[model samples]
Target chain A: MKALRYLALSIAAVLFLVPFYLVVRNGLVSEAEISAASWTFLPSSVRWENFAELFSDPAVPLVRSMVNSLVVAVLQTLGQLLLCSLAGYGLARIPYRYSGVMFYFVVATLMIPAAVTFVPTFVVVSTLGWVSDLRGLVIPGLFSGFTAFLFRQYFLNFPRELEEAARIDGLGHWGTFWRVVVPNSRGFFAALGVIAFVTSWNQFLWPLVIAQDQESWTVQVALSTFLTAQSINVHELFLAAAVSITPLVIVFVAMQRWLVRGVAETGIKE
Target chain B: MSHARAFWLFVGPFAAGLLVFVYVPIGWSVLLSFFDARNTVTPVEFVGLRNYADMLTDGPFLRSLGTFSVFAAFIVPLTFVLALVLALLVSQISFMQAFFRSVFFLPTACSYVVASLVWKLSVFNGLRSGLANTVLSWFGADPVAWTVSTSPPWYWLVLVTLRLWLQLGFYMILFIAGLQRIPPVLYEAAALDGARSWQAFRFVTLPQLRTTSVAVLLLLLIGAYQAFDEFYNVLGTDRGYPPFARPPLIYLYYTALGSGGQDFGHGSAGAVILTVLIVGVTLLQGRVVRR
Candidate 1:
């Protein structure tokens, strides 16, 4: 029985990893090598020039795009963590008259697809002249309804006695929030942070709409432009893709523990 | 902190962003649906249901709706079954659970635009160089233009397969999480009571995952309705023209942004109707799922 389960899981793993394998394998093969045959499971030789040429592509500033992605992801995650935690803490802990209404207002945005707001958001950003700016990219994403919902649900189970004891010590709301609540909710905050970072890094549509020029483009957008350029350079394009997703894969691995906990928590609740 | 002041401070940022970025835009778009808003930034003249009326009579718009409904009908069930099967298999394993979970979930992190582009260029590249076609050729079948071809029989299958590959992992994670919540004691008890593996799953696992199943179904339905990036990136307006590959949301995007003269009013009307349908269906599903 144990051997059967192991064999089944190994097959599942291979199936899941096939796409990533294809990306890496294709990235190493030259144009001539790729077009010679339909598809090869292994490449005859690794073309390291693809990665070198990907960095040198003049149409896309790959390094700049990576910087833009990192800046946006970091800033957005930090802002969301603070704002969502505060709002979630209030709704979960504080006794406010309109708490339920406020919670509903936040959660309602989850249902409102981003596609519905695309046109107007473009108008608003254009009016502010924040197009091609990182602020435009990060600010709108900071207050995530999904993160707020997640944090609130997790905070609901937080022990009330701890906060009551802190209240007895005369710590004000801000003080209690910063020192007590946040310290205790580190796991939840870290979980939410990973999610925020991943979404911001991988986000395409909003960035594509706002960032008209290569200078402001995120990594994903830059990689996409490389793919759609008139001269189809599959080798370099695949290399760019591999490079673009490397940070995400690294982050996923580093935060695997928190991610699993977050998924388990979020899922069991719903 | 006082209730009123603290409440505002806590909820103010979220409310402002939500109202301006979400609710207000929706409301404004609904209002714009009644106007003859052109591409210019000037004030739009109110046409008072002309756009909606036009849509009612528009053959392509109606056809797009039918195409979207058919796509949703096929993709949602196919994805659900695949995800459920994968989840069941992964959950039964005693070790390597997290490794399998991460492998499946990693694709969800990939951008839809990139995925669609890869599918178009590399996977389904319509020539001898294409991956899918090459595999089919091994079976002595000719290569088919997966994206360009809009024949009724093939179009639906191609669209569903693309969507299924992109989406199955995310739902699979949800199912795996749902599976974990089922107590092991139930299974052990079932085994002692002479319940077989399939019987235990049917009796214990299925019922425990009822909420998750409902959530996944509703999410998939709403997601299918709103799908645009894949269709836009993979099958552009160039190929499979007129009525076929155009889902309703894609139609709205094309009318508003495509070269069809940029009638914002008509597009907004389409968006408004799509939003209403989604909201209504989601609410109905919510009630059903909760029950």
Candidate 2:
């Protein structure tokens, strides 16, 4: 039984890992080698120059898109963290009129699937003159209802004494949040931040539609153009795929603990 | 600051963003659904449910919903079983738990576009050099055109496997958390009552996992309905999108945005219809699960 278990695991693990390995292997090889009828498990020669070739290609804007993706993801993460955290804290802790109505409104957004609003949201962004601009890419996605919901759920469980102590020490609500609440909830913030950042980075249809011009494309949008471009370079495409996945892999490796924890919290909750 | 002031100060921006970006668009979409808005958001003519009627009766659009049903029917159960089985298996092992967990989860970091590229160009590509064909050649079998052939509909294999690789691990993590919450004492009690391991699992573990299972199924259902990236990336070609597997989003996108005509009325109508379907299904499923 134990042996069978290990075999199942090892097989699934290999299946999961093969595509990643292929991306790396094909990335560093020549185009002829990639298209060769006889398959090779490894590249004969490492072509580090594919990176340079990819970046230098006029049609493929690798560096600019990567920068755009980074900027968009970072700004989106920070925006979600600040806006959702504040909203969540208020919903959980503050006593005020219209609290129920406000909370209901936020939660209702979660039920309205993205497909329903895809075109109209595009219309909204376009009407605002954000089409083909980073603002189009960043602003619409800045405040997620799901993120706020998660934060509100997390804050409801927070110890009241911490805020009370901060209050007694002469911290106002804003001061208490910035000084005490924010500092204490680093893990939750990091977990949600990782989610928001990865989501923004991996976003496809929105970026594909909104960033119409080549200059404003995200890495995902850029990688897509490779497939449909006039000239397809298999090796360079693989290399580009490899390059695109690098930042996310790094983030996942570094922040996986918090991510797992965050997943757990969401799963077991009512 | 006073409590009222603090509440507004904190939640105000989020509420405003939600109203502008979410609720208003929904209202606009509903309004657009009733108008003769073609190639423009502002319409001089109001059509009054003609758009909604057109979408409901449109063969391709309705078939797109059927495609969603097929996708959801396959993916929801497959992912649930695989993820649950993986969670059970991973939780049983003591050594290198974290390694196995991370190995499975690492793919969650990958984007659908990147994965689709790899799958299309190398893995499932129709050439003899493609990974699947290469393996088949070794086995003395003919190479199959995965994405191209619609008779056998081999594209489903490409689509489903890609989604499985990208998503299975994340759900496994959810099940793992659910598994961890199951008390070992329950298993002990079952064992003391002379129940076998399978029986213990059926009674103790499965019942304990009800909450997580429901949540996972709900999420998987919603996700299956929302799928677009892999379909657009993998099946798409210079010729055009194949008719067999275009989900509602792709259909709506082509109607409203992809085509130069920009038939916003029909698209908005389809969107509203799809939204109602999704919410209705979700609510129905919730009721069923509760029962």
Candidate 3:
């Protein structure tokens, strides 16, 4: 019975790992090898330059897309961290008349799926002349109610004595938040930061719609173009997929514990 | 500053963003649904309920709803059972637990577009070199067009497997969290009461995981309704969107953006319809869960 369980898990693990393996194998191999009728588990020779070739490809503009993705993800994450945290802290800590209503309002926004607002949001962005611009990509996604809710839940449990101590030491609300709360809540921030960054990096549909030109496309959008653009090199497509996910894979591995805890908190804490 | 003043100072940016980005769009969408705002964003003609009526009666739009329902029926239960089983399996094992957990959860980090690309091009591509076809070749079978041939609807396999691979781990993590929340004392009590392992899981474990299961199920349902990225990537081509498996979002995408028709009225109408369905289902589920 014990052996059976291990075997089952091992099989499942292999199944999960195969796509990544195939990606790497095909990514590093020649286009001819990728299109070869005979299947090889591993490439005879791994070409490290396929990624460089992908970057050099004129049609893809992957480097620009990567930069756009990094900019968008970093700005969006930082913005969400600052904005959501402040809102979350306010909603949790401050005694205000409309606080309850505001909290519900944020929660209501969470329930409204992006599909419902996708078109009108486009219209709003275009009306603001943000089409094919970073503002369109970055600004709209900067504040997420889900992240705010997470922060609100986190801050509610934060020790009040520290804030009181800061208050007594001639600190205002802003000072207390910066001096007392922000420093101590690094773990929570890091967890949410990683989540936000990964989410922004992986965002496809919005970027696909907003970033019309190749110059403004995010990595996901750039990758999608490969699907329709039949002239693109096959192995380069695999390489691009591999390269696009590398940052996220690193973040996922490095922040594994926090990511798991954060996800768990999102589910179980509610 | 006063508490209220400080609160606004802190939350003002988020409030402004939420209002501008979320609420305004929703309001605008409702308004657009009532007008014939085609080839332009500005309101052209007052169509009243014409857009809504047209969207409701549209064959493709109705088919998209049916598509989501079929997808939800399969995905929700499949993910729940698989994730629960995975959680249980992982929880029981003492050695290499973290290793297995990470391996399973790793794909959650991958984007849907990249996953769809890999699935379409590498895994299930019609070429004999493709992984699925290669495996078939080993069994002396002909290379079958996974996405191209709709007769057998083998495309569902590609879609389901890709989704399962990407999402199973995340749900599995949630299940693990849920399982961990089930106290050891409950299991011990069940054991003292002469319950078998399966019986303990059936009664104690299942009952303890009620909230988590409800949350997971609700999330899965929402995820199903909001399914766009994978479907759009895997099946959508330069030729046009595939006739089969077009979810509402995709249909709306075609109506509003992809088709170049810019039928904002009908698109917004469809969006409102979808929102109503999602919100209604969520509230209904909430009531059921609370009971």
Per-residue lDDT of A1-270 in model 1, one digit per residue for the tens?
A: 768767776786776676677778778888887666566767889888787777777765879989999999999989988877777877777778889898898887776677656665665566567888987888877767777788888778888788778889998666777878889988888876887788788777688777777789998777666554424477776667777788888888889777766655554346
Clashing pairs in 1: none
Winner of 2 and 3 under lDDT = 3
TM-score per prediction, in order, is: 0.92, 0.98, 0.97
Better of 1 and 3 by lDDT: 3
Worst 10 residues of 1 chain A by lDDT: A223-232
Q: Compared with the true structure, what per-residue lDDT tens digits does model 2 show for residues A1-270?
A: 988888899999999999999999888898888889777777788888887887888877888999999999999999989999999999988899899999998887777776557888987787889999988898889778888888999889888899999999999989998999999999999888888888889989999889998899999988887775525688888888889999999988889898888777655446
**Tens digits of per-residue lDDT for model 3, B266-290:** 9889988888888898788878877
Among all windows of ten consecutive residues in candidate 3 chain A, which has the lowest summed lDDT?
A261-270
TM-score of 1: 0.92
Tell me which residue pairs clash in candidate 2. none
TM-score, prediction 3:
0.97
Residue A189 Cα positional deviation in candidate 2, in Å, after optimal superposition: 0.6
- How do the residues B173-261 of candidate 2 rate in per-residue lDDT, one tens digit apiece? 99998888888899889999999999998999999988888889888988888899999988877766777799988888889987468
Ranking by DockQ: 2, 3, 1
- Those runs of model 2 whose alpha carbons end farther than 4 Å from true positions after fitting are A267-269
